[model samples]
Target: MPQAQQLDPDTFAVRHRIVLVTAWLQVPFLVAVALLTTGLGQAELGTIGAVAVVALGATVTQSIRARAVLASVALFAASAVLIYLSGGTIEAHLHIFAMLPFVALYQDWRPLVASVGFVVVHHVGVSVLDPEGAFNHHAAQHKPLLWALIHAGAVLVTVVGLLALWKVLEDASRATVAALEQVEAERRRRLEDAERFGAELAREAARLVDVSGRVGEVAGVVRETQEASSQRVGELSRRAVDASRAGEETRERVGSGVATMGDLEQRSGEVESLIVLISEIAERTKLLALNATIEASRAGEAGRGFAVVADEVRNLAAQSADAVDRIRETLVAIRQGTTTTAEVLDQVEAAVDGIQTVQAEVVAVAGEEAAAGEVLAAQVHELTTLAGSLSGAAGTMSELAASGR
Candidate 1:
């Protein structure tokens, strides 16, 4: 009935040795008790057979139950042989009681029960069948059955007490073992949790490190882009100022051009007036030439030369009127071209103003962005450092968990 698994390794080892040693020692012990009971060899084959049985059961039995049951039963036989050898001495029975504790050491009641049964059978059977060998006194031989019952009762009482003690021991041992196993189970569970948590933390830390690294790279790129943008904004702003300045100069040039245009307009007006006066003089000359031709016709052949001079004067007046008309057409074209050029200059100045406003705003926004970028880069650097620290902690935890496992 003894289960080896119930005992922890340490207790099992110690009890194992004790049981084996005691079982083996029973052989020599029986021999010594027999010699001590009656100093010499009065018996022959019975003692030898009994001793041999003890030896075989002690030595040959493998299992704890086999060893305990066989050895305990054999000890009863050995004690019976000693009793017979001693002529049924009262003290030879003590050997039977002595072996009980040894089997009781197994913490298994079944072996004790087996030992008791063997003792009962041997006492009744031996006393009834061989009273001379089973009893030392003639009084016991006359009523061996009563004597056997008395001896069996004594053994049962001892066995009952031992069984009580065995019950307490069995309960205590099982409780201790159960408690130890529970502790080991909880310990193993805690270790598994620690290993799982450590592994998970390590993996998450790796991901954090990767993400932080990428964040750092992205921050660097953003920093570079911001720097470039800031510089470009500065350049544009400078260009805008230059354009504003250019716009001022253009305004001044436009003012000068307006003044020049006004002078050109006035001069063109004078030329127009002069053309009108010349046209009037040409008409008067044509009329005077016509009147002279009439007078010369009245004077006949002497007036022929005067009439030819009037015709040349009329041709000269017509040619002068045609030249004045061409001059007025050219003046009108110059005035229209001047007005278009002035309008284009005004538009260029307005566009320059708009460029300057947009450039100034861009520069302001770029400056704010640059400052924000610096702050973001600093935070990202901190995050990367923190992630590294977490990774290191997780790595250390993993090492500890692995070692513990």
Candidate 2:
């Protein structure tokens, strides 16, 4: 078989169905010819039965090409039988030409050629065998050759026209199949590209999630450090305030001590003046006792007893003067000690004041540090929250990409 003759299964099936339908259609024409010739006799029944049998056999056949070939032969045979049975009716001859176009359904020129050949051979054979039965009329019997030529010419024209049309349809079918194949290839390429893009997107999303998680971890650590530092600063601030209070108290106590030392120094000065007056009185008494003793000696022997009494008084006065001198030395030592103590108290008071000033500055600095630490802690907390949100967003994106893939 030629390439055109060997059709795909679907094409064969379609041609097979056309052949069956055409075969059945021929039955009416065959019946009409039989009725015209024999008037409802056995010949009409025989012709219809033969064509029906052929169509049924072809339909049941396993091979599509065989079915087409059988159907073509059956149709051509029916055309010939109908013409012969009608006593070679001219109208019955048209059936042969009509079959040419129907056979073209096979999309193969071979079936058409076979149909044409069968018609030519049948006409010649039947006309020679029984001229009266093949032509029916006297005129057709005399010029059988002329009639055969005219019928052949008509059939040839029909064959040429149908085959040309078949060629055009076959070309179109092949082109359509090619176009569909190209479209399918493009669709497959697009699907593969989408899959590749989805994979890359999923990887990027996962990377973003990882980066966000790391940032969140760092933010958490920073926030924790800020909180600890803030707590320590607050504690230090409180301690500074307490230290400032203690320094002030110490300064006041030192001031009080210095005032007490000043009072002690004034009392020591008054005691020193009284000791000087007592020393003068003792000296004057001693001089008076000595003069009394000298007057008693000048009064002679009667005044001897009085002179002894005066000497005893002068001795008592001398002892009193010596005691006064010792008392005056003790007072001078006490005055010197009080002055030194007062100077030391003044130095202590000044040191306490300086300490209080330094403590006040420390308290101010510690309070400022605590306030700054609190602000830093708040900022760190905000950053941590932002990082957590970013991490969550990246996670959601990753999940969506995964689901898309």
Candidate 3:
């Protein structure tokens, strides 16, 4: 059994009022028809007036059951008046069926049942009381019970089919609502998942961007350090080259000093030889003076002066030989000092050579360091570029995440 409570109440309310109010349209049409065909009289006015009262009563009633029952009575009553006013025309009879859809639109079988029941009663009452208003044909007029039963049977059949269809439509509507709710649930879930994933992606992107920024900053610092290192290496290389050059100059000066010392040593040896020859000559002279003194002593008193002169000459030669001996010792000491100075100059030359070699090695190592610094700086620059790219990618991801949220 269908009750007045609708599956969709809001829609039912609007349609319910429309059904009730629009049922009045038939009243005026029926009245006009009555005026034209049967001519307006007391019965027509009385029927139409009663239907208006019933419809108004339905509007005022709070109980859905009473309202539905009253609306149904009004519809059938109006149809009856329309049938009578049309002189029981076939067109006028269609109003009864036409009113059924409005009742069905409310999705309530109460109005349908009530309308069917009212029609059956009205037909039974009318056929017995006044068959002309119900049937225009002779057979329907004569056998009014059969025609009325047939009409009631037809209405019952249509209402049964309509109720079945209404049930089908109602089920379909419920299924549609359920399916829509499920779809909405799925959509909400998907939206939540998207927002969560987007948030995760944004967080990861932010981390990447932050890490990239730090990397870029570190790389930039490293690049600057490497550039400074390269410059320092270059300066060190130049200094090494200058030191090598200075070492070479010092070695050359040392070589010249060593050569000069060797020459001086040779000259000292020659001077010593001359001093030895002079000492030998002085000894021979002393020997000759001693012999002359002995000869003079044999000559007596005249030779006394000659012996004194010979002794004096011997003393002078002895002094000259002593001086030559001291000169020879001094020349030996000079040669010894010259030999030491030559050896010292040689050592100094060797040290300068070692220093030059070390400087050369330093220059080579500095060159290598500069090259390595260049490579390091290039690597740092590449890292900075990589960080910039990461930042750009992160920014794009952040924008995408923002839009998603």
Candidate 4:
């Protein structure tokens, strides 16, 4: 067999089934045509028996090509037997040509040629050996060889034409089978590509989902930090304002204390002047008492009592002068202390002013920090939103990938 004849299993099976069916049909059709044309005669019975035997043999054959050849030969032989039994009727001869077309199903020229050879051999052999049996009484008597040649010629022509047509059909079938195989191969390749693409898509989707999850986590952390920073900044701003106000109040109190210390210094000066005047008065009184004692001493005995009183007066005056001197020293020490306290108050006021300046700067910085924190929070929120969108997109992609798979 040629490579073209070796069909795929399904094609071979289909052709085999068609051949079997045609065989069975041909046998019955031959018997019916023989019986109808010849009536209950020995020739009809013989033809029917021969067809039955051939059909049985073809059916029992195991090899596909053998069975096909047997069936083809049998069909042609049965047509020949029918033509003989029908007294070489033209209609019966037409059955031989009809059987030729069925041989094309085998897709091999061998079966067709076998069938043609069977018909040709049977026609030629029967005509030569038993001319009376091969044709009707009239055909046998009138130029039977010529008529046989004519019939053979007609069969040859039909076989040649059918062979040509069968060749065309076989070529077309081979082309179709080749095209179908190519199509099947392309389809398989495409399917494999699709599977690979789907697998790659799935992996990409999984990676995207993982990245989205990480980004979302980072966004959450940033948002949380922003919130904490905003809160801290707000608290610091409030405290800074409070500290600034306290600084201002402290500065005011320091100014008042300095003023009060200045007044104390002025009062200490007045007390110092009063102590000087008392010291001068005590000196004068002591001098006068001394003079009186001298006058009493000059008058002796009678002035003795007066002199003792003067001496006591002089002692009192001296005591008053000493007390005035101690008072003056104490006042001077108080004035010095007041001057020191005033200097200290001035230093404290300057420190308070510096604190106020520092406090104002702290308040401004705190405000700026709070504003920056709010901006950061807004940015974090935007990032979180973007991360959420990415996560959603990744989830959609995952679902699509899974569905595609």
lDDT of 4 by residue, 195-262 (tens): 77777777777777787778778878887887787788778778877877887787788778888878
Question: Using lDDT as the measure, what is the rank order of every candidate, best first?
Answer: 3, 4, 2, 1
As a whole number from 0 to 100, the lDDT of residue 98 in candidate 2 is: 69
Q: Which pairs clash in the backbone of model 1? A: none
**Candidate No. with top lDDT:** 3
Tens digits of lDDT, candidate 2, 1-405: 223646778767776787788887877877776777677577668767888888777778887666777789789888877876777878778777767767877876666667788888877777677667678678768877766776778888887677677767767776887898888888788767767766776777677777777777777787788778777767776776777677677677767777776776677677667767876776776677677777777888877888788778778777776776776677677667767876776777677677767767777776787778678777777777777777777777767666655
Q: Given candidate 3, what's the lDDT at residue 207?
A: 96
Across 203-299, the per-residue lDDT of candidate 3 in tens digits comes to 9898989899899889979988997898899888888888888888888888888889888888887887788788888988898898979988998
**Weakest 10 consecutive residues, lDDT, candidate 2?**
1-10
Whole-model alpha-carbon lDDT for candidate 4? 0.78
RMSD of 2: 6.5
Show model 3 residue runs off by greater than 4 Å.
1-5, 17-21, 40-42, 50-75, 277-327
User: Any idea how many clashes model 4 has?
Assistant: 0
The better-scoring model by lDDT among 1 and 3 is 3
* TM-score to true structure, per model: 0.54, 0.64, 0.82, 0.82
**Clashing pairs in model 2, backbone N/Cα/C closer than 3 A:** none
Kindly provide the TM-score of model 4 when superposed on the true structure, using C-alpha atoms: 0.82
